[model samples]
Target: MEEKFDLLPLLEYIPPSSLDYLEWVSVGMALKHEGYDFHDWDVWSQADSRYNAHEMESKWASLGHNGGQPVTGAFITMKAKENGWLSRQYEGDGMETFGWDDEISYERDYRFVDKAWVEGKEIQEPGDNWNPVEQLQTYIQTLFSNDDHIGYVVDSWQREDGKYSVRGSGVYTKTAEEILNDLEKYKDQKDLGWAVGDSKKEAGAWIRFNPLDGKGVKNENVTDFKFALVESDNMSLEKQNAIMRELELPIAALVYSGGKSVHAIVKVEAANYAEYQKRVEYLYKICNKNGLQVDSQNKNPSRLSRMPGVIRGEHKQFLIDTNIGKSSWEEWHEWIEDLNDDLPEFESLAGMFEEDPQLAPVLIDNVLRRGHKMLIAGPSKAGKSFALMEMSISIAEGLPWFGFNCERGKVLYINMELDRPSAYKRFKDIYQGMGIKPANIQNIHVWNMRGHSIPMDKLTPKLIRRAQKEKFDAVIIDPIYKVLTGSENDAEQMAKFTNNFDKVAAELGTSVIYCHHHSKGAQGGKSSMDRSSGSGVFARDPDAILDLIELEVTDSLRDMQGKRATANFYAEKIRDENPSYLNEIGQDDFLSAAEMRKHLAAALGDDRAWQISGFELGEVQKRVKLQTAWRLEGTLREFPKFEPVNLWFNYPLHVHDEVGVLKDLDYVGTDKPYNQRKAAVKSRDSAEKKAERKKKTTDELISAFSILDEGDGVVRIGKLESYFEKSRNTIKNWLKNQDVLMIDEEGFVSMRLELD
Candidate 1:
């Protein structure tokens, strides 16, 4: 009554009612009691109709049977479209296939060769032996016959083997000569290559590639990946051959890759390695953009026929029960059950998350602003030390961090392990990227003195005192091991260092961030502070704690060169006990409108002004606050964005307080006039130190007259002086007796223009 399929392989096509992506487990369990193994069981399913049981029920109803008898199952899916084939197709075989298709289902197994292959192997798979040779014939005839494009890009992902390997995805295209010749066009000038790669394949999709021609050595980390057949369900018009797309031909080519990680090779011979790497990463982007996901974890040992959690937990019992079902092996059932009980649970940690989630909460989850203390810990090479160095430099310079705002403050990084030059070189890369000038790089200071032999107790307070005097706002003690020598387990010793560190910070008002390492065997449920190798010392000593967990990733770049790897931050404690800052839960010092305006005006290099007028504090606040400008607490004489607000705090013109920045700033007198206030100093009327020139005029006139009356014709200009000394110019002018007209220029008081 139904239209029979006409193609030869149509009969070989497994019914959809039998096998499904989610039906394998129940089918596995159904075959559990019989055969040497579940793989011996068989069913047939069409790829499209495997998971619909409702249609099978209707079919059985038409047969005048109740629900007892199983019917071929199927699924009917349709989107909002004018499809001409307004019909449902059914396909399935065997009890599992003929049964209902719900979220839970056992697979439909069919086809003689497929059954044979499943029987031969411990596990059954749809792609195991689906007529590979026959499918190959179909593929070449249907898809490749008339194709003009000689190559195809293949992307493969495997859950095992902890390596993110890559290779030429463009399958065997032109001859090696042609490929090399094309890339050689850039030979006139050495330029970086392009980028390719799907985002799923690597962290960032850009890579480097040169000619595979007789130049670089062969890439050793090369391999082929086998994937399940669902990868090609969605194909673009550009991807499919015209012949393949037109005929509605079954194009069932598998997902395979012949790729190698050319990272090292690319690095070696690259004209510009960074550019080339970016180019290779571009390839992966195209692959994924083409609607492809090759996430196929290996399914070895087959899925547990029962609940996975149960089967693994009671593997021994399942084995014993399996053996008991064998008619001849029934007598050894007790022995098998006991043997099964002793069997260890099969665990494959190949693709499991390497870092602990519990600890992630303790790591830096949000942002880390300047003036924050954190105790970072992990094993050696776990990046504890390197991270401290990087963080110190970054915070000090106010460099961009993971796209958040950076605040610059003087970071006194004291490290015993690394040399100063080595650490400074690392800072160069980050500093340059931010477009910050070197002279403004004063925020980052790597102390040269190594603390190799200094015991924690012997570490003098003078070290931090000098740094405080130098105006460093932050201190970093890299690796707590450097200063600590005695019992790390002793809470008393740890408390001492913690107390001292806290004391120094309080006295100096500097944030002190410490670093330590994690103990071995720390895994799930380990708290960050818990991982510190010594006896809870790190926990007691710092205000914040960030854990470092290195999860094994399959990224080639991360595997080799990325030392200071993926990191996180956490704020465990906020020891805001500094009395100076206490009860003062307020924002950091920010410039008022007038202050910012004045600073910006001064910095823009305009000179010769009256009282620095026209700069409104409220108006300047409106723009910077509305626009969200950079920090400039320091270095504001240049209108710097680095620590923008800091320039206002310590600037001589402004004093910061809770009520908002008090702006009646006085000049911080210097032997030399303030360079920034040159115009103000220049415009100032000299010899005006006296209060009310009128009040002092008469006294000075009387004094001058008295002096003149007692003098020999005239008084020396240098002789008459106030309790406050007068300059020679002041004395000459005063003694000249301009008001009373009594004194002369050379300090000779001669009667000149006398008062009436």
Candidate 2:
């Protein structure tokens, strides 16, 4: 008898407890009983839809198969149904019974098989040919021979019993050839397992794609990029594979991830990281187009996939498809050269601009809006980084930054210029200066990317992935120039960098702020934006640009150290906001009372003095340079003949006396000059000084109460006390003097200053 291939014994070798392994074994045995064995020339070709005789015969035999057997779709489906591993996932289907008249189609339909069988045992070929280990090594080498900068981890292995063992090795940067040369070192160790990174890196960090070459030599570049599809948890492996085939992805290998999923690696033409990302983007597009979920998260360039011949977690990880996308580097390049270049579709703009008419979402009011980009530029050592740190902490803690409303959120600070120690100290000092507990700064993450000197292109995606993973609401990149490899003056290069930042901001739904240095000179004649050094593109690209202008040293403004005590912050550019009144109109261009009356008529739809409350008047002033709603009670003192009416925050016609004004009008009262106002008498100081301080404190207390009333009357007593630094009784006494401000039945203070 010709050497009989004993299918029963081989099937028994597979653990029966594994549905996938058992399915494969059953199919091979079923085929054996049908008078067809691996010796038959067309068994696989006839059973699987993926093969044609002319296409598979030569390649299939070359994979060290004596044509003994391989798993087919029919076997897997039949075994799955028999084992009851599926839910109500199938309409109807079963494999043909070998000795019975009943027959069923073995095609997988709606079977909810989250996992499937792949060849576990290596195929043993005849004498002196390629051994199983070499065959696997060759397969791996061929899989990535056309690509460069591949990272692999070879320090881990699996035993024959399927237990994963690791020798504590880190990622090794090498080429396919380098890995191939070291195959013998690991071949005899356990099951000879390995894994390859999906992304390429330099100095242990993902290399950014930049056009210019810097001083340090980078890893060899990869022309042909590889992508892997991690099966969705919602679908069966059969369905996923079917979708991949339907989309016609150039799949190179199928790996059992030692769990319920399989990783399908595909090969695509990519000349650089830019091209690689585009290709991956297209992959996602096509999958979405076809209603398939291919685990887009796995497409990152730094992602790692299972090595073809590795053993993982009691399973032999072997290649299910060889001979796919396999070619020499030159051949691949040549082949791709002839194909038309295609780009991924631009991200959708639908529903992006839809906004509430009355309220807009803000990451930081008038400064850093969600999904917007900001540039904070100043002269070197002008505290731009310091200010950014303060803002980052405020955002993380949900506190206001420099009196600007801020939404609480997770923040990421990418430091590209400062050293790690300096960066740490800066953050620590900022928290301490702001009176925030270091332990309380929960959501601020700092990435110190300085000494390594990675370029922006390679760094952008990595940062994006980090932000996406961490769900950051704001990302601050310190000294944007350090992250850039190109000259700042080059508009094209700067545009590219800003565009990347904008893209990341949009994708993460967060605000991005980049610190920059200002050009040398006084900013007297220049707008806030014009002060930034580098191409105008940097200034123009962001949604907002804030400039910190340090004033010349003056005796009155200086601190004890005689340094310039303060800097003026200007919102040079707020895309949705009108220019500031102080910047647009000269200081001497104060609106006359008639002009104010006319402006109120136009703005509030009435020429008569109108009631304005909350931020309404301030908002109008910022927009149209309107006169402030509140006038000093002492203003009438200048004209002693005029009736005394105290000014409050509410706009237009209302000025109240010490007691009350018309029911339709409001007033504030002052017995002394506004500048001469004083706090309440807490000590036995002179009555003159005490009176002066009391008026000042009362004025501030009312203003504080107005601010705390966010269109609603409820005001926190503690808030007022802390903001005014006054005792509760003093605040209550001041409130008692004004009939418009009173405590409600709820024990909360309410502002009843509105005109009826």
Off by over 4 Å in 1: 1-372, 402-404, 429-439, 555-756
Q: Per-residue lDDT for 1-756 in model 1, tens only?
A: 945322222212222232334333333232232222422323322233233444433432233133443323221211000111112234453112111122221111111111112211121122322332232223223222232222222233433433332334433333333333433443333211211112232311211122222222223211111111112222231232221222121222322121211011001112343433343332212222222211111111111011000111112101100111112212222433344353467755764466443321111223332334567665655444545655665566565432334466677777777777766665675445434566656667777656344765555454643554565666788766778856778887777767667655655566667777667673323534576787775665555555544332224422221211110000001122122322232222121333323333333334421223245423433333322101111111112233112112111011112232212222222232223355555456443444357557757666565654554455554455542277876656654434553554455554454458
Q: What lDDT does each candidate get?
A: 0.36, 0.51
True-structure lDDT of candidate 2: 0.51
Question: What is the alpha-carbon lDDT of model 1 when measured against the actual structure?
Answer: 0.36
In TM-score terms, candidate 2 sits at 0.33
Per candidate, the number of residue pairs that clash is: 75, 29
lDDT of 2 at 358: 46
What are the models' TM-scores?
Answer: 0.25, 0.33
